[model samples]
Target: MQFDRKDKNNAVLLDLYTQLLYPRMVEEKMLILLRQGRIGKWFSGIGQEAIAIGSTLAMEENEYILPMHRNLGVFTARNIPLKRLMAQWQGKLNGFTKGRDRSFHFGTQDYKIIGMISHLGPQMAVADGIALADLISGQEKATLVYTGDGATSEGDFHEAINVAAVWNLPVIFLIENNGYGLSTPTAEQYKCQNLVDRAVGYGIEGVQIDGNNVLEVYDTIAAIAAKIRKDPKPVLVECLTFRMRGHEEASGTKYVPQELMDAWAEKDPVANFEHFLLTENVLNQELIAEIKADFKAGIEYEIEAAFQEEEPIANTIAELEDMYAPFNFKPNALSPDAPSTEVRYLDAITDALKIGMYKHDNLVLMGQDIAEYGGAFKITEGFTTLFGKARVRNTPICESAIVGAALGLSINGYKSVVEMQFADFVTCGFNQIVNNLAKTHYRWGEKADVVIRMPTGAGTGAGPFHSQSNEAWFTKTPGLKIVYPAFPQDAKGLLLAAIDDPNPVLFFEHKYLYRSLTGQVPQGEYQLEIGKANVLKEGRQLCIITYGLGVHWALAYMDEHPELSINLVDLRSLQPWDKNAVSNAVKQTGRVLILHEDTLSTGFGAELAAWIGEHCFSDLDAPVMRCASSDTAIPMNKVLEEDFLAKSRLAATIEKLLAY
Candidate 1:
């Protein structure tokens, strides 16, 4: 195994040996600390250091690498100050996530490292996004993303790889097949003979390498990276390695047989590489001792510094501070005196998207059938010809991957607007939207400037799947803005505002209002304040608070009953709803009615009613009333739907509230 001194890769072998040794020593120290109750937990990459070190170092400096919890070598190889990383593990204020998260759950843009969330397979799709950004920007950069053998079974893994292969994206899907995922063995995870063999179905090149061999990993990944940068297609590399320790320090390795552990210990990456360096005369016993001593001292110094740092305290005000990035809404952009034209609600959204594309060069649109087919509702018709296929991408029916990719794009200085063919389908991508996109900024200060276009609400008898008002689901999740506009003008203006805001937004477009609703929209591009509500009419008897279809229902009910002097308020944004406007209107009217298209139980109206009851209880002449549909699945029959809708009983509820 000894290499000749004349060998050109001699220096590289020495560097690799050092990189592999660093994480091994760091993990050993952390495990000792764990046993002493100093640190909380640690996911040891004791035996699999070669995969993280080799794969990360193989990529170019500007390229991105999405590392998993066990990829400690990736962080250390990039030379991220060990003190900062130690502070992160200690839950100190100076950590990458500011103590919002612990371990390798945080990412840093400065190092081109996107960290992994607990959900394993989503980052694979996110890597596609980073690679897509590089390709769109005409940069020859590739993205390297890691996953385990068991996680390869996740739907997101397949979706991500398939999309990257179809689009010829420059992504390296690195799988560390460590034989087990926690306690579940690979035999129980998938039926495939070899994990790398799955690449054939994807029509991509697949390579199987002995992950314990640092030299092999480095050489194979370096070659693949070079090939991908030139050709720009995905390649799957399965690194056959073993987990020498438990999933976490606390989790024992009782399930692993002793013979298997003994077999893997012989192939220890750090020891094996060290032996080779020693045998090659590149390192003597003294030099090896010196390197270990130096690294140990450095780690101890960093850990001490981290211990002296301040721990983050949980404060209500501080908790809400970084939930969203600063967004300035310019009301003057409305241009009320500009030329205007009548357009449908759907057309207004299309116009706003067109304006956004023209305005922001880095803005990208992704969804199923969004490019040539113009999306499920023809909202993006002619967009492909106007904007090109790169920006307006037609993704596979993989909601999770698409949403994850949007977050990845946002991480790399791009704004993304994702279209869900139907709002109900967002359930497939729920984890990405709620966990990844919603928590990115709060956890790591990375703004997910993503807008998910949800064509929601029921009226057209599209059945239970297609016709559900699901805004209430996302309304409960913090760090997300929910905008549901009723009129065409509001839809256009609100959409533009959502695009401009540096936060994840759920833009719910009422499917029923697509062609049925029409209004005069200003010709010039404009942005409206998302958190601001509009007073459609001012009255003194009772206040009707609503948004989306409820706004139209209230207006129609008011038209039918001219005697009811209603103070109608349209709460366009649900997350940061116009609380002041709602309070003011409730005080003015003395009686308030909350209306929505969602089911009665746990609908967004319930929240409004609770808030009004809490804040404006004294102003109310009567108890707060909520008018909503019964708690039942949306029926397919139009007749049944009409009876099921809240609109059928809106007038009666209004009468009851006003009479109170």
Candidate 2:
């Protein structure tokens, strides 16, 4: 029934009367379930049901809504099946969380709505990201993030809000200011009594509405959404309501005074809305009884189904367990077939990037000196010419911001290539890369298709921060691909592969080899690939595993020491490196030597050596070995720089292998 604009009383009666009743009934069932041990805990949306329903009803179906644990009404209204939801609450196999995610923390890939999360702040940032994507991709759908007033104190909340405001993201932040954050009230927590007022600092519109009045809440939200969908700015709506129940089903009762509870209970939203409905004749007592009965039966059906569902199998739940992909640093494999066309490794990389950028409009490039300077090494000198300034652009020295913004951009339907001036500088943006970009897809099942190009490994006299070999640091980060290219042709192929990947990829281009390494690469649109190994040579006596510039050195070593038969493998992709190829070569030949330019303490070489030793234990005549730099910072001294690198130590390690 429409809340006829003509009758003021009819508005509350028809629109919010049932909304209020449904939430109260749901809460009652939630309490019963808690008593029966069918649910672990419950967050009551009790006194503010009208506001919850009103704000939620304002959104389009395709538009995204991310709610906290207290939003059962929103999830149920959105059609998230009650049985699956109850199963999740019961920690059963058929739970909406697929028996993997925590009860009350649910996510659905099919529906746009994100599942509830115990972790408060991340959802705010994630909601903004979804809106950013919609804005960039030209998608009509918007997004809303629902959080309590207390959550505003979080750094992630501020960070997300600031960025969203600055970028004019199509998002709405709905704050349920239900009097307190558990034991503490909003006044004690924040200096500003109004949460909406906080938006003034971020340069966006902020509004406060009466939570008990469903029509007011709905109209306010609808107006804001309309303005936001047109202008696409972040808005904060502070709902003035009260929480009738304790923070949890059985907790917070000790802290909350009964007198205060009585005060809050007197203005009970369900009764207020029901009275309004009756006053306007939108509904009578008989209809109210039937509505309660229908909701009662629905809740009963859901509870029964939760009990009837079968236990989840181990393996199916295991898929949810593996959101964090394992990292195997160096795979046993040969280098990619020498570039078919004669070209430098940097040249192949440039070709691959340019081709991919042109082929897919979503690909974009950003770095400190990339635009006018065309990058420090000038690899991207003409990238802007081909891809245009919008696609190929430069950024400030804010490494953290660059990586964070790129992550924000990726969710918006763009594949970003974020270039750190040097591999050593990745430390600056380490948090954003690992915590945000790397784990986004893992936690939320959201894709972050972006490439981080860090010019790595020490060889030149660049020294210390500029010349550290930090591939192992990134390889340790799960859900991120690490690719190290040695030759020009392989550079083009692997880069092509990284751009096409849906996962975040860390492309560690060797600073020393950018210009020095040369090979054949097709000038046009071909790509090599990521996740495969290149066999530089096949031998019977021993197998040598190397990557990046080490591949060049290994090839040169083989050429000089032909009397010793050693198969060489250049692993192009470090994260998902070719384990099969490496193990196969180790199986073929009993001897294996892992080599890298990084330090020996915890380098990729050590990982490779361990894997080779494990899988090929009986196949080997001798123990596995690694030839890498000592555990020390890259020296500033030109002469000592070369000495400190794996290059100087490599010869001796090779001799040790031959002697054995």
Candidate 3:
């Protein structure tokens, strides 16, 4: 290839070559490390460098890029140092994640890059959130999220794009259809000729291009980015490229056909782009050789220095410290002379949200039918009319996308309180809550100040799907605060506390008590300690530790049997339970009974029993007993529901404990 002195895009081509060279060198260094047994595995974006560099080059500053494992070229395009990545691969203290992570699974707020999870589709929803935040703030920016053909099959992909299209968010979804998803070929994966065809169903513009052509990919992205920045909307770009290596270094490609691999090898993105540069006289033979040699030497030097960096030791105290983001807010005490109004449990929660939104302009409310319909339980009636649609968002039926989007909003200076419609539906969004929302702070010290409001418990015969107390599910997961308040005052106070906290919080509201429970709520703002238990009544014979609807049942049983002397302790928070209060009550009574609305087997009550037995065994006169609903799913029949969480059954258990 000969050079022409007067080329128009010479500087652009040279810059692309410089950025593209970094990732290729990174892959080469990683391959050497993999062979040397220093790295466990390597997911190389060897032939797909053009798609990474081209797409990223089109993005402007402050725009977000959610990168997957195979999109390492984005790092090079963003000008991240090669040594930092090398140290991360080596699991050294100097790594970006400080040895917490070793793969492409990391992100920093400074770079506007979100670290991807092993599950590929969730980041798309997160990108929608990032774009939505900018759109709401009237900022001119877009979010670029990358995925592969395999991720297209995930429900999150559909849910994410659907929300982006409906809301008209400024997000560009780039899918690299790399012929094969690990071992399954595209022929076996989808029936459509092109993945872009699915965009019609989503009502969004879709474009297809030869991902191997760097200029084509770059031009497409640059054009779309310009249009979307002026008038925000989602656009899907399908880049038809092929992975030239196995899914990982150790995973051999026996399933890939030899002829297919050879055909794709002929159209290598890196080689083709370099030849294009030469034919256009953008670079001479000597200059190309020098550029490659310089990149190689630089990578080699970084790798050598990274090997000597000390690896971080696993420390329990450090792990505990990062479990929750620092939250310090000593709320003003409830004014004694302040006017009070009798409000139901549901209205109390609504009042708390209204107060939270009024205090913090960045507070956002999101859920299905929440904005217009005021939620299924009518907890947010008139919210949309008061706060406007921008703050009170009515989301689609996608649970995962709703929560995932809330995480994005949290990072972008918004406090999102997402309602799950029903607690049972939370399982649909479990991955985002457990893996993304629950672990975000622990992994990168980023506070995901998102509150998940769950309408929990059973009494209206809503059956297994609509009625279930699932607080124990989140209590088992770290990096989350669980609050289940039984009274109206506690519900309002705890919800305010949850919103104020600087970490992810799970706020459970018992559907049974929404209307039935009423109390005098303070008119002014106030917050309660999240992990403390309230002692409603004091006695001497036995101590009943309960929460949510269980408190009502325990109180009713005590009223029915006056001879049974007991103290009622309401555990408002499940995760950071009031251990001191529980211990003191058990010591005074010499007998303990734990109660909850969740199923009996492995319930939160079991944890309380274990703690009491282990910590206060000698202080107790009898073994700790637990009373809860049966392990079976909540039945629709009235008789079955009664027997499931029966007060009579609880009374029987209490009698035994008192007799002990």
Q: Candidate 2: deviation at residue 89, Å?
A: 3.7
lDDT of each: 0.91, 0.76, 0.88
How far does residue 633 in candidate 1 sit from its true spot (Å)? 0.4
lDDT of 2 by residue, 148-206 (tens): 88887866567677767766788888888887888887778799868889989989888
lDDT of 2 at 301: 90
Ordered by TM-score, highest first, the candidates read: 1, 3, 2
In order, how many clashes per candidate?
A: 0, 20, 0
**Candidate 3: worst-modelled 10 consecutive residues by lDDT:** 1-10
lDDT of 3 by residue, 462-533 (tens): 898998888888899999999999999999999999999988999999999998889999886889989999
| RMSD in Å for model 3 | 1.9
Give the best candidate by TM-score.
Answer: 1
For every candidate, C-alpha RMSD to the true structure in Å? 1.4, 5.0, 1.9
Q: Give the lDDT of residue 496 in candidate 2.
A: 74
Model 1, stretches more than 4 Å misplaced? Answer: 1-9, 333-336
- Cα lDDT tens digits, model 1, 1-660, are 222323446677778888989989989999899889998888988999989998888888788999999999999999898899999988899999988898999999999999999999999989988889988998888899999998998999999999999889999999999999999999999998999999999999999999988878888888899988989999999999999999987788999999999999998888878887877778889988998999999999988888999988789887897889888777746454788899999999999999999999999999999999999899999999999999999998899999999988998889999999999999999999999999999999899999999999999999899999999899989899999999898899989999999999999999999999889999868878898999999999999999989998999888988887889999998988999999999989999999999999999999999999998899999999999997999999999999999999998887788677
Looking at model 3, residue 192 earns an lDDT score of 89
- Ten-residue stretch with the least lDDT total in model 2: 325-334
